[model samples]
Target: MKVPVKVDGRELTLSNLNKVLYPDYGFSKAEVIDYYTRVAPVLLPHLRGRPLTVKRYPNGVNGQFFFEKNTPEHTPAWVRRANLPAPGSTKNRERIDFAIVDDLPTLVYYANLAALELHVPQWRVDEDGEALKPDTLVFDLDPGAPATIVECCEVALMLREVLQVEGLTARPKTSGNKGMQLYADWDCREEPSVYAKRLAQFLEKERPKQIVSVMTKKARPGKVFIDWSQNNPAKTTVAPYSLRARELPTVSTPLTWEEVEGCERPEDLVFTAPDVLARVEKRGDLFGRA
Candidate 1:
């Protein structure tokens, strides 16, 4: 069924409202759209002016999924886009017109497409669509099998101490999967990506058994891989408050430092769409405070 709705003065045609997108939780596409609409106030700020890469699960989370970097040709004219040079593009013509979900209408459009995972780089673009310096740095704490979010939490706390020593305040958020990520301000850092790499390496050396800095999958088992690569200009991390393509409708919800220190189990930090909405209503944007 298609429904015509006007939001923020824009007319949009939404479809597949009754289709179940998260079979495990019986969460439907309509619920996804509603989640994005209600969470727009907090989610939009993290997405505005950043090139978005969405993980689309058309048939549902149990079905196949694909990543979308280019804005669809049928994208509405009013929907904002940032024309960025393709990662390895040598020619001017090789560019991707990526969507920028800066408002409720655009957010709904992506949600309607089953774009459950919204990924963005740490940097934002200028009015001319030129990339700006990254405003934030992220440490993507991915736990290899045998390890869980509890292990990630231990590493996150360690990272928080190091960042504090650098006079930077680190914020925590769940990956909405099995791990967690830490974010901090990056303005004064000489090179955010380089610094992140060095920091990860340092941590790996300090706690050889608990952390792995390299991207080698073979070395990941039973350890937390500190993914510093997300700080690179070309890479992206899942946006806070965006849903993951998991069996359940899990959201990448932000956390308070106290929560990070107290997490003892993987399930302790997992949050669904309804959980996140309620969290925002009560505590507000914890990440924004950093």
Candidate 2:
């Protein structure tokens, strides 16, 4: 079963987690509806309440499209097929709602809040601090494995060199979780769409061997993954100051490499919900893509 949801007047089909998504994530429509009501208070205010759309599914997303029923006949044409149905949500697709955010705090806050609401396991999006800014171009080197900090930093340096010669304003930040996010500020382009296309083009031409310009599981790191898509004006990536996108019982809390060393494998970070307030308070400039 699926239900109708509206965000800023945009209507979308919300899959029913209990009915459409996975068995583990199943829930009643009313329950999922309640989930949104709570998180919205935490973020919609910060987002300035822009028109938004969220596709709720019961199970895994087949793809995104007009949900039908809830959509107002007067819906904007620009919203048609607003996005590809979110691919990798929980196994239960219907128990979700995507929100609009204007700031990193909201992004982090809402993500953590939503997970708490659903009580499901979630992963953190190790967003590059650089990627959050509109002025710079970012190369997010995401190594899906637990490699050494030295190795990660070395990769950041190498990628930084590539961005420099190309005349892109590239700065590196420790995505504050794992991997790194390299941002390039392009004085040449002001439009986010143009930036994404140009950067994707650049990566295709320069780093043909490594994967570039992909998202979700398509761009997991074994080799370097160049993400220019977050530069898209239509989309947003989490920020360093922004909380690591986490689900309930798990926040993408920051950890020193020393902590990483203590773990048996990368799997250890999945369940961690550290009291990160102290660290967050200490790192005041963390929000600035540092």
Candidate 3:
């Protein structure tokens, strides 16, 4: 595939792989392409040809939303962009988090009773309990602090317990960065439009308030937020895998827990074509063809 869009005078290569790109943008290489392919097609119409400014990552985080545009903007960037779900945009943020990839490979992964917690849906729904016989599933985790994968997986296990108690079945994934994402199977007919609000609300009532919320401006070190209300409409959080600007290159990008303690963070990740693709296969996103 050949794409002509350029960040500056630089031209980008289009990789025809089942991978997520723009991991710095919280997407793998293939996923970067997938978004451009799957969600972007639908989003473009909503965007109406406006240029877009994407947040990129290059470093460390104590949580909260942190982003930086590393490179120059596209000449006259898209005026509108698809945003994460925010509060009061709907009844809750649940709807936004519940939808699953409709593609075949993704479906196979979700069907794995053991892995559902990692597959993680985008919304939390309370509609009819009808969705529970789930052809659909999603996993979600709230990262509390620096911990081991064992600890994180335990959190995932706890999440699965929560779902079962609530009558939803799901599987979990490691996220490869930090935290775990769980998924449940369902036949949801709801649109993605209302997801953010519902997700924010669900997060609000579900977790104890964090010491931090999304950064409205720069933040002091050692302070992080657990606030989910920022997921509300008109508000957003940086997508996972998106980079933050850090002083060191290797140390500048987001990493798995094994590295967070020794990591350095200063600014944020700048979105680039290369960062885009890494996130794709990293998440095994193309496992399903959604």
Q: Estimate each model's TM-score.
A: 0.97, 0.41, 0.33
After TM-score superposition, what is the CA distance of residue 160 in candidate 2 from its true location, in Å?
A: 2.1
lDDT of 3 by residue, 6-108 (tens): 4324344443333322223343334333334432222222222111123322112212322211112441232122223333534454222222232323322
Clash number for every model?
0, 30, 111
Question: Which numbered prediction scores highest in TM-score against the true structure?
Answer: 1
Query: How high is the CA lDDT of each candidate model?
Result: 0.91, 0.39, 0.31
RMSD of 2: 11.1
**Model 1 per-residue lDDT tens digits across residues 1-290:** 89999989999999989999998899999999999999888988889889899999999999999888887789999988888888764334478998888888899888999999999999999988888988999999999999999999999999999999989899899999999999997884588878999999999999999999998999999999999989888889999999998888999999987888899888899999999999999988887946
Please give me the total number of clashing residue pairs in predicted model 2: 30
* Highest-scoring model, lDDT: 1
What are the RMSDs of all candidates, in order?
A: 1.7, 11.1, 13.6
Quote the positional error of residue 141 for candidate 3 in Å: 3.8
* lDDT order of candidates, top first: 1, 2, 3
